[model samples]
Target: MNQDRILLEETFYVLTKKNSVFRVRLTRKGLSLIKESDNQEKKQTIPTRDIIGCKCLRSRKSTTSCSCQSLPRGSLKVVEENSGEQDENDISAYLYIYAYILQNTKSGSCKRERTIITLRFRSFDKYEDNNKEAKRWRNTIKQLIKGEQAQNETPDTPIMHKINEQRKLLVLCNPKSGPGRGKAIFQDKVVPILQEAEIPYDLHITKHANYAREFVRTCNIYQWSGIVL
Candidate 1:
């Protein structure tokens, strides 16, 4: 199997003397052998249950914090240095990290669709554990941003206020980003919040790279005050 495209718990089938039989194996890379022989060519689907075990371990959500996940480490490190310490416990600190991450990505320039945020913290003792910390921060930030703040809190309790935005939104999804889970994240998580808030927004699914740019050019910027990538 090719090392580039293997997924965990992926399977493939093989033919035998008596009849065609299903041979299952787990591939962590989501990869499976596509049999293409002179005698026969066919497509086989591997069910998650069929996998007795996986060759590759599932990636933790904290992977987003790693330098290798999408952007370079040095770049993130430089941004972190500029922002300050990568403190997971501090809300402001995590927000700065989130801003830094977005800055490194090419799509950071997309207008003010919403407050782009990142949260970081310590993970396991051995590893840097940025991803784990980032996720924890993400949850906390979302709760605050979505009007979960207490109205009658004392000075001691932190206040969570909504940041007013200036425009409608169109979220352009990149399937490749976040290991093909970007779209799912938007659908399952982002969409509901936008709807609950009565925020005017649309979802555009892209099949290839650079589709967002093309879509943006054709789209009427006036209709949507903001664009999220």
Candidate 2:
């Protein structure tokens, strides 16, 4: 996987069923759970495609002051200390985190049954931050699932029989052409036709003579299936 294409990579405190926290690496590829003592001794990977859904959980009541009892388990402890009492709503303080539900198929089983895996993040003081992170993760996981679904839905027919479904075109116009009627012509004539035909196009205006030719020479021609003047 290209590192440049990685959508998200962050260290999150995973909450366990025993009320313990484990430091895990959340990335586009999957979840990498790191061991307490060693980094590589005990590691687990969960592919992003396995994630079924994610939900952001919020506490019913908001509080300004909070404490963590299990710091030894690598939990994040956020404590805001102020001399005067402050309203929780004013501070925008709340306990929130993201919960991801994953499903994995059992291996070597006669009947295909999915094993449910629940992963949760540690609580955060600010509701906004928690909600933002949860939404980001949810969207990324959804994109992965959508890509997988699209791949599965595509036909297995040969490439020769396949038709290009993408409607893309490039339109070039000279701003000074025909006594400065290029812009007006494009707006009045070209745009309406393209819209009526339901065609998507990239428009470029020429600044001077031979400008279109120069642009065409430098541009990536592979992006457009057809070019229109």
lDDT of 1 at 32: 34
Over the stretch 1-229, how does candidate 2's per-residue lDDT look in tens digits?
Answer: 3322445545553444244344555555665565565444566666665544443333222242543232344233233324233323332221222223343446643432232233443356675665566666655555453343222122542222232338478888877876789789889967854553346788888788888889889989778868888
lDDT of 1 at 45: 36
Q: Which regions of candidate 2 fall more than 4 Å away from where they truly are?
A: 1-6, 38-40, 61-107, 110-125, 148-229
Error of 2 at 81 (Å): 26
User: Which candidate has the top score in lDDT?
Assistant: 2
Q: Itemize residue pairs with steric clashes in candidate 2.
A: none
lDDT of each: 0.41, 0.50
